[model samples]
Target: MGCTFRPHFGYCRRISTKVNVLITVSDDIYDVYGTLDELELFTNAVERWDINAMDGLPNYMKICFLALHNSVNEMAFDILKEQELHIIRYFKKRWADLCRAYLLEAKWYYSGGDVPKSIQCYMNETGASEEDAREFIRCLISATWKKMIGEQSMTSPFSKTFIEIEFNLGRMAQCIYQYGDGHGVRNHETKDHLLSLFVQLIPP
Candidate 1:
């Protein structure tokens, strides 16, 4: 199947404010493994409005965050693993707020952690009769393509082909509803006018 396509919306209510806050921090902690103290620093500071506390951190912080988030849940650890990789590919330097937001997608449902969204994406992408909430690895792979590869390739010296991030989102939603059952993506509905672009390209 091809990537998903969604129309561009000018902006959401807080997207602009959040984006400005998310990308303004001048740090990429992906490279530097944090000491116990360093971990506590950002963990504590993140709650506040200032991200400058993370400034100049190594590039490995992103990695550490992914690792920590995965360890928080096992049922969806596999999906979490791919999600981590997707974030790593894009930042290539540090973890961003958007990454953090998606990582926390599950928190909104099933109480906390990657409870269903991640698994739903996996299940939807794989189109597997996984019954136990399984997913195709390709969805996460496409995440890297849509968020990392496609975004990065766009500015690189190569042909810039954008992956349809919107399609992946639907597949994700399908997985959420399929796997989540009663506890589906109640926190955030993935449906959107954007899904219209898929037409015959992706399954509804």
Candidate 2:
């Protein structure tokens, strides 16, 4: 459930419209992009691709939506990695086994028409204080990416989009972390060594 870091090629065309949206109450991000703002970005994903109008999406359109999806997914990877490590460091095998079991359960629940329950189980597994559990939480985002974006829902069969999304996530995350040194002070919005280091790492 992790990205190996690579890029996928496709034509991305923008579609614009308003949407009825839900604001997620929480996040795990390297930076705090405003929730309403990101919500618009995501709602536009569906609108931009004309997803709401379609009864069923063709494979090509699905791929385009997946790309937009992953770009938003990138915003949270760094914070997810940080918390995953903390939990994994504390919980050990119990957390690992629990997450594994929960992964199975989530798959089962998803297949069995208990989607909200499945999401809850997935989140519960992630909330534990174990390395494996936490690692699952972090990498699971990639798993989700592969499933939704690559059309491979089973985590065991990951694809390039999944790997590249996480890879790009990691790169940008390192950029964000190094950009601030956790000071959360000074010119966070300006050019600095941390950002310079990020540029060196990814050449952005």
Candidate 3:
């Protein structure tokens, strides 16, 4: 997805795209498809990092988990072979954190309590007042962008191409969350951008 510029880090860009796809799929499963119990099981399986742990998952969840696991492992393999870096720990930690965050949202959604839709589920989970939640969203987005910008200015082990990909991702994430998941809803502007970005032919 970050290959729009025809950069030399095509492999890393592809890996980044795969990681994004996995996260999107898993988010959909947890938010739209899975029951609370099934999500718990799947999250546990990921946390445990055991193939056997996947045995109890539903067929759909098992499929999603396998795709995520295999893709992550393939990326790790690439990093290891090319960079002499064993970054699997970083990948695993990120995935586990993703699962935990998603699980919290799912729990809040299914708690069967009368929670106002105006307040985000995470706010409900955190016992934040609606006003506080609203303020927090602003602060969170600002803080996240600040951090990414700061990271971009710093020296890091990651390649410049990889950092650019991360910055693009953060920007996209901010856009997606700023207006109620426009990408998922395929809002007019989002649909137009998606079509242009993903479907239009490039001039040779």
How much does candidate 3 score in TM-score?
0.73
Q: How much is the lDDT of residue 62 in candidate 2?
A: 45
Which one wins on TM-score?
Answer: 3
> For residues 120-145, could you state the per-residue lDDT of candidate 1 as single tens digits?
76577776566544435445555654
Worst 10 residues of 2 by lDDT: 13-22
For each of the candidates, give the backbone clash count. Answer: 17, 10, 0
The lDDT values for all models are 0.41, 0.39, 0.80
Point out the higher-scoring one by lDDT: 1 or 2: 1
What's the distance in Å from true for residue 2, model 3?
5.1
Which lDDT tens digits does candidate 2 get at residues 1-204? 122322323211111100001111111110233233343333343444344532344443344345434433332343357554333222233423432443444444445545343335655656654555546655865676556555433464556555555555555444444434333346554356557544756645
Model 2 TM-score, 2 decimals: 0.22
List the RMSD of every prediction in angstroms. 17.9, 17.4, 4.5
